[model samples]
Target: MSLLAQLKILVVDDTTTSRLLLRDALETIGFRNISVAANGEEAMKMMTTSPCHFIISDMNMPKMDGLQLLKAVRTHKVFARTPFMILTGNADRNVLEEGRKLGLNNYLNKPFTPEDLKKALEAVVGRLQ
Candidate 1:
């Protein structure tokens, strides 16, 4: 089996359209087990029970954002080292630096194509295949 097929990924985005787009892109890249959350809060709750091998989250969200989620995830022993990618329309240097400090694995700028997603995933967890 391809390595991507065995990995479970969590995708968190505030917009439903973005989530669907991300899901479709992930499927195209050979990721079968994809879980989605509408917000950081929802994603955090899901992580308590269903851990993911990788995480792709929107940088800005209500009720908790990507940075907040990253901090929370890092506190937990089980998910501290899980590869994490932040998706953002605003590639703010400060935010990127902060994410880096908190241990983000990669970042994908918004309005990205499937190829962008593939590249981000590749950077975070090696080649999807």
Candidate 2:
């Protein structure tokens, strides 16, 4: 099987609809193993037990937010180099800059298409078939 098909990804979003949308987008991109967390705090807990290969998180979630999650992930020895991406509606450069400082691999603006998602993933982890 292709690596993309087996890549384990965690989708962290506060809203149920957003989580479902992101998960479906990942499935459409040929990723089979996906998990969802309602907030960054929950995502952190899940990461400890499940150990995903990647994390795609929303920036505005409560209970730890995306940047907090990114910092936490980067500080962890196990997930320090794991691919991390943020999904944000805000176009503020400060947010992206902050993510960069925190070792973010890539990020995508909200309401993106599957093609955009593929490109973002490729930018982070290389070309996806």
lDDT of each residue in 4-123, candidate 1, tens digit only? 879999999999999999999999888889999999889988998999988899999999999999998998898888889999999999999999999998999989989999987887
Global lDDT scores for all candidate models = 0.91, 0.91
Q: How well is each residue in 39-85 modelled by candidate 2, as lDDT tens digits?
A: 99999999888899999999998779899999999998977888999
Clashing pairs in 2: none
Off by over 4 Å in 1: none
Whole-model lDDT, model 2: 0.91
lDDT of 2 at 29: 88
